[model samples]
Target: MSLSKIKAPLALAALSLVMLTGCGKSSSQTSKKQEFSWSTSAEISTIDMSKASDTVSFDQLRNTMEGLYRTGKNGKLMPGLATSSTVSKDGKTYTFTLRKSRWSDGSKVTAKDFVYSWRRTVNPKTASEYAYLFEGIKNATAITAGKKPLSSLGVKAVGDYKLVVTLDRRIPYFKSLMAFALFFPQSEKAVKKYGSKYGTASKYMLYNGPFVQKGWTGSNLSWKMVKNKYYWDKKNVKIQQIDWSVQKTPSTAYNLYQSNKLDALSLDSSQTKQLSKKAGFQLINNGGTAYLQYNLQNDENLANVNIRRAISMAIDRSGLCSTLGGNNQPAKTFTSKGVMYVGNSEYTSGIAKSSEAYNKYRKSEAKKLFEKGLAELGKSSITVSIMADDTDSGKKTVEALQSELTQTLGKIKVETTTVPFKTRMARREEGKFDIMVSTWIADFNDAISFLDLLTSNNSRNYGKWSNSEYDKLIAASKTTSSSSDRVKDLQQAEAILLKDEGITPIYYISTAYLIRPEIKNVYNDNLGGWQFKYASVK
Candidate 1:
């Protein structure tokens, strides 16, 4: 299952204040006209991807909104709405020439459109959960904190087709960041006209990418993305429309796929074996890590390190993975393998030393840790609340963990809480629960995206886990020039984090989608989950 489906409620709730916001099925009434239609397990919680904090809706919106740049099949960056760009000698400034583009409404897309959108997102009043994505952008942090005015933000529109951006430092993966939904340009007219209703549904906003949304009820179970006539690359863009519906049941999605009513669907653990033999069944590796996060700030027993370590040791990741599904490997690091690169070098390949002492898999060792923790805290029992979305895998994992904890950790009571994707996200931000199941998808191909959340101030820190030394290493590595030196620094930082048991590492998630052979140029990246540009159904 996608992380967004599990954590959608809480993530959406986190953006509830400034937000204006905003799934699938198949039908076969077809002609020779090339059209691509797919179904997600759940409907998108919001359509305003720029302000979105979750990954699921962001992936869909990436198909609708063109960013400053986009990623190609090779993982290299390519121009999206920007026709060309120039970088200054200092590597701190970038100037982009925007392609002639128009909104679905026939209004010309202008430089001011980007300027207004960037300012609105970073505005302190907006309270965008994704505001931190603009860290390197000059004065963005200060402007978002209300220490400076919006005019001081590092972006400026030189003309109707020119955009100039200044950064605090040179970012290697900066273009990939621009390809994400958080950086997609928004219109000032749309925001003001809809005011609080912006991005609520298909009609709430305009599109500039290959597809424009239509026939969405905002709160309903269905929506569609029609080909955008005003898109800059309309000539090469295929797929006239994409029809989507929401089916929360894994069985239903599988049945639809089998009946040829749906072109693609995800497999549950039960369906994995049976469907692996079917034609067009292939696994798309998406470097994602799934794990349980402890709300250390709330629970007294969980606030102690030994107890947290004990819980980590008790989890049988191998068994849990078997129960969940195939095409997944147990994770030992927060940033999974193939997640980031250091000049064609795997970042953690050399530095993550394999030692049984820190491996955290022994049940006997876990019991010892739990007993020691109890003695220190003077408590006989520990009750932990495990929060998850209301889904099959969510329920299964929670049950498995509960059983493991009860059997391994003496006198432990594991309570379970299940809610919709949006509500769970709200509870996570307010620190309303104890331990929860969660995953972080990379916003950019950088280890810092994973490591920075443990910093004390990140609002995304649901666990309230903190380590000053880890923060120092992550900060230093970001500015370091030598690739080898930076990799070592990151590895050292991961060592400290794992030793501290900041979060339990489960397994890196891989995406499983069944696509028609005729579908061309559909690409996904570790940064944005997926992008639909260059895709054609023929």
Candidate 2:
């Protein structure tokens, strides 16, 4: 399975938001097209589902590996290895019928493949960043916590073609979550055969998805994906090959596009302004939220809501939007707008009113809050470190924030630290900084994908921010059968989070890309990742 499915939810969530906004970046074409080359700003992290976390690896994996279900041509959930699934009356049990399929090496894909894959991921030793996504599965939490054995994970392969999964509760987004790469089955034989070195290179992994990575060194800036003959639906896989290059510089990618060496190009803030007037210029709403997380574990002051609110209020979100480019918008809530819809209204728009003050630039109020917070802390001055990605855009963004905060908030000395994406992620996971600049693409399309991070016990809650009332509201939304009522509960949860300044919302992402007219069926998912499964180059 393409590991990028981990991040696919972020891009996939855009499908709902984009359709509502009518800002889709693609148009369809029927002409047969073939052999396309692409570029990425970041490098792949890993193909191993147990370890893959970043968007690049997820994007690569989404195409190279097959999941139980795959996002189809129209962004609809479509069956892949599973012929179909049946849901029980209560919606807590799912029985999947596996299709007759073979791995790239010709071994039949059995139900045990899924059983083994899920067990391996939730096993304490595997240390999967995505293990948290398995919370709804019965015994999944216990297995990951090392309290239960793998066999207790509540998933059973009834027979070669039948698999039954019992979840602890109803998950409205369970189907979409299953379609993600993290839920895809790994060939047990292939995994154990490669063992420690599995997923480290293209050669070590087996393929059942539409394509398989070819010539991938596991850390190369260049590689290829060729149509996998072993794919059960390979006949409909019109595009036989995809070429890839990792280019962080937009100008370099633009030059490559001009030279016909690249089929698509992503524009930077500068490029967006320069090329947006021309045809094929797309500014896609990715339904992604970028924000700042305070590491309450790093400092006592970080735990103070007053300090967080002051810092959040000092942000000039409108300025940040223009500076960041790509048609980014100042975010009004932690959850990306359009992530959920209730009665033709957006989930973000329907949230409870709070003194949380979303995106209002109030330097005086921020200064007052900072002063009050300092008094409460009984401190004269506090030094804070800002950890951010080392990408050009990331650097610029952090610098912009640092400048804004330093200029507005008194006595708050700022130290800026920049590192590669992986290193930064490690730091975030370890809770090693005072504040961190981060963006989350939806793990699955829902407000919870964003709000869930604020829960005190969530593994991804690096900040250590917690509130019981907020947790209860979110916890209730999970089991609520009424969609409208659930939305109301989620709205209150988001309001409580913002009112407490649990996180500083910055902006929602918009994917800006330059596409050649010949590239067809190119769709960007809600989470800010691209789907190239149905893409073709004429």
Candidate 3:
């Protein structure tokens, strides 16, 4: 999922702050009597799993939807709708035994829900951006490409409670992938009833998870997630209601936190530094990488490898991170650190030395390379604009990049444009910018979640960077049975991507937040996406 910029709404008003402050009862004992208030910078773009592409929407979906498995603390797979699953010996087939569950509307959730959901997402008419994620499932790629019928997409409802899935090849991370919101089951009855209006707002959707969303009007900046009575695990749910609001400015959100109006506040760079020692402060490692995506197809200057490399080397990533703090780390590769491992070490560690030259800041070398690239293109100089969100942090990021590029690369002009988060995302998808500042959080704890986006055929490869060898290595990594061989293939692929400067890795993001002391069980998945399913306010 992509990162987002904040939008402001009026402060949530007149809500009771139900707190239990007695000595006899433990925090857990009083949890059910409390409500939690949370803040987000962005609005929910869409609740429809097939169309939701931003982190905000995905996080909200996780709260109200149940997949086969739910991602637990540290990326552990916890059973949701599925009680158990068995894989075929060749690893090409999986059969799941679903537990008895009921949707918020009191409809039984069966294997047919899974079958319908999968088919709907992969159907060519659905135009789902996430359909590419179903690549390994048998005929999924072909179905999405309109080369095969939707019924041939390899998933079936064996019975009311049993579901089967066949894969075109072995997928090592298949189980983890199921934890994503895109794999969640949808109610066919609700979808058909609502049709085009489905998932546009909370009222149009059905929930089978721990919570049922309400008060969302699609474009509204506030909403509520109330405990779902029909949920199978409702007895274990503590928080009775979660009030969510959007606060565009960090200071505004911080004020709400200080006044007890909010249970949590996401901090920006300045706030992180100012409140580092605060009691409720936390630094969350968001297993994602922010980078500069060059428009190779439209921008002739950016099409030159030397120019791309020069732009990459011109920016001092360490300085940039210092400017925009929150414990951001300079990225040496596109994949974030700690997502994958090779032998006893992290995968990024293996390629550190090889990637140093390209990632390191060297103004003189960058200028030389920039000049040579201009000469090769038969131009004296060139101007390029960088686009980013219009929020405070987004402006800061693009300004820093502009300063670095113009100062380091002589005779080059750098421009900047800041738009709303949604607009920026749309422009990026259309390849409408010279360089777009993009952030990608891993869908799972695997390097492929980041690497596969830049593949030639990937729908997310907006920059249009293509390399045959890179594509081959990525394809091989997916099908290889040997764990060590897969690592080697991925490592070599990363090296090629860096050498060619397909994209300029900026920094690894670590978000800072101030969470109330009374809030408990709130945690993040392995990929750093927040999880509040089990959260409670004491």
Can you give the TM-score per candidate against the true fold?
A: 0.92, 0.91, 0.93
Candidates' C-alpha lDDT: 0.69, 0.73, 0.78
| Deviating ranges (above 4 Å) for candidate 3 | 4-33, 342-346, 349-354
Could you give candidate 3's per-residue lDDT for residues 437-470 as a string of tens digits?
8777777768888788889988778899999999
Determine which window of 10 residues in candidate 1 has minimal summed lDDT: 13-22
Residues 470-518, candidate 1: write the lDDT tens digits: 7788777767767777777787887787777777777666544555556
Q: Tell me, by lDDT, which candidate is best.
A: 3
| Steric clashes per prediction | 20, 19, 1
Ranking of candidates on lDDT, top first:
3, 2, 1
Better of 1 and 3 by lDDT: 3
The alpha-carbon deviation from the true structure for residue 110 of candidate 2, after best TM-score superposition, in angstroms, is 1.6
lDDT of 2 by residue, 467-507 (tens): 99999998888878888888888878888888888888787
The lDDT of model 1 is 0.69
